[model samples]
Target: MTTQKALIVGASGGIGQNLVQYLSEQEAWKIVGLSRSQPPLKSTAQFIAVDLLKRDDVVTKLEKLTDITHIFYTAFYGGPTFSVPVAENLAMLTNVVEAIEPVAPLLERIVLIQGGKVYGRQIGPFKTPAKGFAEK
Candidate 1:
């Protein structure tokens, strides 16, 4: 069986770090962690320091990950204003996708990680817990 390779972007964040650990334990997975700084935990996974805001940097760094099968995108860029964060976060995610799609021919899936902010949590307290939009 062919080994599955996973690229975890924003690997230094809480969710990203956890994913790195989980994937590292799976014998069938080869893990690659991408972030601005190396994660504090030690693991067999390979680490790449990359600024997702810069398309050139993302493209250059990710081009060699030709064996990647999946991408877990946990990277987030926050700003004081809502619009700023929205724009920057989108740009970062776009950079990663654009960079990987062309070079990683084996890529099959991309997972985007989002939190309560998507339900307007940042604006104010919610009357009820945030749930998936499809949930009634």
Candidate 2:
């Protein structure tokens, strides 16, 4: 059977840490985790310290990963006032995508982890709880 490799960005975050733990338990996945902070010592996933804001650093580090198959993006930057900075947030995600795309030819899937902010619940106009999300 072919090996499945997963690259989890923001691997030190709450969701990212859980995902790394879950995927690591599956024997098929070769996990590669990236984040600015160091992962917990108990983490089995291979962790690489990286800052998405540094484009050159991101490229330098991620370019060496050639066999990645799946990407889980959970990185986020929460500014003050609970308002999501759309441009800054998009830039962070874009940096990862741009850096990885050129290096990961075997990449098959990309999963972006969005939250309630996308639905304008906690970041923008207050809408009915049931209201579906719309682009700002």
RMSD of each: 2.9, 2.6
The lDDT of model 1 is 0.86
Those runs of model 2 whose alpha carbons end farther than 4 Å from true positions after fitting are: 117-136
Q: Top model by TM-score, which number?
A: 1
Q: lDDT per residue, candidate 2, 1-136, as tens digits?
A: 6889999998888788889999888888999999897788475688889878888988898998899999999887776866667777788889888988888899999999855555656655665554534443
Model 1 compared with the native: what TM-score? Answer: 0.86
Scored against the true structure, residue 87 in model 1 reaches a CA lDDT of: 70
lDDT by residue for model 1 (19-129), tens: 999989888999999999998987889999999999999999988999999999988776776533667888999999999998998999999986666666667777776
CA lDDT of each candidate? 0.86, 0.83
